[model samples]
Target chain A: MISQFIFIIILGAAVYLFGKNVAKVRRNILLGKDTDRSDNPAERWKLMAKVALGQSKMVKRPTAAVLHLFVYVGFVIINLEVLEIMIDGIFGSHRVFAGPLGGLYGLLIGSFEVLAFLVLASCVIFLVRRNVVKLKRFTGTEMTAWPKSDANYILITEILLMAAFLTMNAADYKLQALHVGHYVTAGSFPVSALIAPLLPAGAGALEAIERGCWWFHIIGILAFLNYLPYSKHFHILLAFPNVYYSNLNAKGKFSNMASVTNEVKAMLDPSFVPETTEVSRFGVKDVTDLTWKNLMEAYTCTECGRCTSVCPANITGKLLSPRKIMMDTRDRLVELGNNIDKHGKDHTDDKSLLDNYITREELWACTTCNACVEACPVNINPLEIITEMRRYVVMEESQAPASLNNMFGNMENNGAPWKYSQADRFNWAEKG
Target chain B: MELNIPTMAQMVAEGKTPEILFWVGCAGSFDERAQKITRDICKILQHVGISYAVLGTEESCTGDPAKRAGNEFLFQMQAMANIELLNAYEVKKIVTGCPHCFNTIANEYPGLGGTYEVIHHTQLIQGLINDGKLKAEGGESFKGRRITFHDPCYLGRGNGVYEAPRAALEVLDTELVEMKRCKTNGLCCGAGGAQMFKEPEKGNKDINDERMVDVIEAKADVIASGCPFCMTMLSDGVKHLNKEQDIKVLDIAEITVRANGL
Candidate 1:
């Protein structure tokens, strides 16, 4: 009863912490600016199919893909076991895979146990890939975060998971040895048989150890769950939906410019554009300038830096790095969240929040190539955010490259990009 | 009644209910060779009993170049005016010899509610050939003429009109050698997206020059194009390399006209 009470308290605390963290993360994500204006339904559907179900981006690197897939599948399957564990801890009877369904449950648990092992093995390979193999492309990337600590966490989590699986196996083995009529133990006796030899000769000691390990496993899982919202592992939950809603259309297609008259009227009259301000513009300069979806994308990023690898500008030694853009946004959101948490809405009064995070040059360096969006495993659209900033710079602040300004002038005056007479339009053709 | 040279207004003035509206875009109207070939196409249409009205000077820029330059407002203004003009005449379909005009009219104009069935002259010529209305003379004097088609981005990737131009070239009895990058992946002639209007950003080699090298590598005697802009650029590149003496640049329409012994 005492153990059950302790487990309940821990579980409750974990659920509360996880829920709070998720809400905070969600609020931050919602606060970023939106810039994507794609209307291509076919592209959206293809993206949804490929990224969501096909796991196309993740599979581009095979080893990590396989490992991640096992972990993903195990995490999903283990949810059922979690519910069963909670029920068993509370009620004394494990009814999840009991009776007629016992065979199927035993098979599922056996398969999941094997998958968990594979997943753990894959995590080790991932560590090697990140550290020892140290692919040159990953050198300056933001995805290579605190490698040693992350590896340690991953290793501990895997061990804890395995311990949980083994504890359950040990209990089933003992029950079978004692001739106790447990549903799962009947079909799982062979697995139990192998583990039984490793157990101490004394049944009482083994039982106590089993009880302790089981609690440790459960506690470890709850702790991991609580840590999920604060760690890079947050993508384990966020990437699914982000992939589902990814943009798949042709690159560099900006959303249709809103009708200028509508915009003006909206700004002048509150009824037109309900969300308008005297100093407000249609681009993101800071966290507040971002839309909800943009923020969501920042939060959902797995920091794999696949986006940085494919960025043409980054490849050519340009200032633009898509991974850094996401990281900056995420870090800024956390900073803002911390501020808001401390000072409430008065956090907006804090001037330092806007000073040093993201720069205008960093925003302008993008070529608006959809490479970042295409390369991102979680389907974050960095180009959309970049273009949104461009729109703001161009429309609101009247800021643009001088060449663009010259082109604009030539376009207005000559109906072309040159100051030469319209007669020059056919000069080359006349020569031909 | 004397026929005033068929300006766009004059064509529109003849009657609202013409059989076809020949959209002699700015390039076709202004370029001497393009104007000559367009006149030849008009004669061919007349011979085939296809009555058409030409929208002459009233045909402004299709705003493709402007839009590509990131001047969205100018594009919208031009598009809105063009839509209004076309709507005024109740013009159902438009035919143009210019691929840029065709792409702009067919693809970009719809964004401004200016939807119309637009086709390239090559498509119409192919249709004429398929219907047995157009026939090419066999074994015409030109020999040792290995020609390659330069697939303009607006025609090839922009609208997927690859086969029609190739069909026109095939009918001309020229050996059609393809460059390395043809069809959808075809290199730009450095004239697209208003690069014709603005100086191209400094790169190691001009895009058209890079493309012409492929043409030179193919060892083709002539570079034929469906778009006038491509013809001009490729010709310039060929000339800059002093390959002008060995090579010739001709529009597919001009080649077809030549095949018909015009």
Candidate 2:
């Protein structure tokens, strides 16, 4: 009874802490400016189902997709068993659902053991890929220190958790064979049954191992849950909502700034007075200038360098890595969120995302090719952020490059990007 | 070799509206090399007897460059002016040589109260071929040569029109080779997002040079392109490698024109 009480307290505290972190993430995302992503509910649901739930986009790279699928499907399925653990801990019942579920419980546990084994093997392979083989996509300039270790750390934690789960099942199965008190002949552990012979024969020893493994497994999962908010593994949660709200329009369309449109309307049609909102500096200067969807995408980034690997600028050795753009956004958001927490919302950092984190050269080098958008397993649009920052640089500061300034001037004065007269537009036809 | 390209103004004056308004983008109108592609598209349209008219002098830049360069003021001004003129014409179907113009007018313009069935020149040619209007058999045989098509970022990945341009190329007798990074995985020609206007920011290799490697690796005599900006970038890449005499960078329309005996 005392152990059960202690378990309840630990579980409650973990759940509370996990909830707090998630709430903090929600607050940080809301700190971004609002843009309506609520339109097209039907399409959004379909996309979410396909991309996030179905893992449709993931299969473009078959090898990683298969490995990730094993881990993903396994982790999700095993959490059902976690749900049962929560119930057992709260109610102080041994395999509480066993009597009602009957043979179905056995079937479920057998399958879970198989999934746990797969999860363990997959994580070991993943650790090898990241540390030993070192895939080029994972070893980019942005995958420094914490980012690199964050991936490995989660994989290791998962391996440890799965090991404990299998070991616990094995010990419990042996105890059931010994006919120990409260150790019912329940769950059919096909994989763990192999290890039953390797365990201690004595009921007392088996019970000690079973209890130790159960506590370790549950605690490890709770700790992993809390750690997700601080790691790239947060994508496991954010990818669903991130993909649902991703841009559904044609990839070519960069949205026209409505404020700019209103200004243009007044100049073009004097009779039309457009409604205007109080403006901040044009485009994205900091994390707050970004749309909430953009902020969510920042958090949703898996730090998979699929985008950077395919980037024209990055491929040719330019500084712009799309993955880095996402990382920087998240890093800045975390910093700003912490600042607001400590010093209130009115705090000033005097440092912005624009010159401080992402450089002008990095911004200028992007081709806006949408390679990054397509490459993301989850639909994260790094191009939008790049264009928005470019907007602030051009409109707010008039800091466009000399050539782009020339191109803009020519377009305004001559109706072409060059100094050619509009009269010359028909010159191509005059040839015949 | 006379072509039957009329301005919307002239066609309207004669009480005969064209089936499609051909938006002769700034590149097609003024870029010296791109002008040849403009002529070839006109020849194909004439050969196929599709009633298409140019926007002519009234047409302005689509402000893709301006918008991409982050000058939203200039971009909106251009977009609004263009949308007004396009609306005035009551254009139902439109086609353009450049993907940038097609994307902007088709996708972006509708939000500003200007929407039409905007199709790229490659898609236009692909349609004509599929409809049995343009027979690309033996006018200028490319049977002995291998041709690789460079996917313009805006056209292929941007608008998801990868297959149309390839369809036009497939009709030709030439070997249609694909680069490793083709279709949705296609690399940029280093000129998108208004990058064409400015010097590239301190990269080890120019994007065009990297794209040219794909063309070279595909072992093609010709690199077929649709976007004028791509034509310029890829052609400059050929010049960079001094491979101009060996490899020709022809627009898909130009290729279609050659194949149809126009």
What is the Å distance of residue B71 in model 2 from its true position?
0.8
TM-scores for all predictions: 0.69, 0.98
How well is each residue in B177-250 modelled by candidate 2, as lDDT tens digits? 99988998999999999999989999799999999888888998899999999999999999999999999999
Highest DockQ: give the candidate number. 2
Query: On a 0 to 100 scale, what is the lDDT of residue B42 in model 1?
Result: 69
The CAPRI category of model 1 is incorrect
True contacts kept of 1: 0.02
Per-candidate clashes come to: 9, 0
After superposing candidate 2, which stretches have Cα over 4 Å from the reference?
A: none
Candidate 2 backbone collisions, by pair: none
Off by over 4 Å in 1: A32-50, A56-67, A92-100, A141-213, A243-253, A259-279, A349-364, A423-432, B1-10, B16-82, B85-112, B116-262
List clashing residue pairs in candidate 1: A29-A295, A32-A290, A32-A291, A33-A290, A33-A291, A34-A291, A266-A273, B8-B55, B8-B56
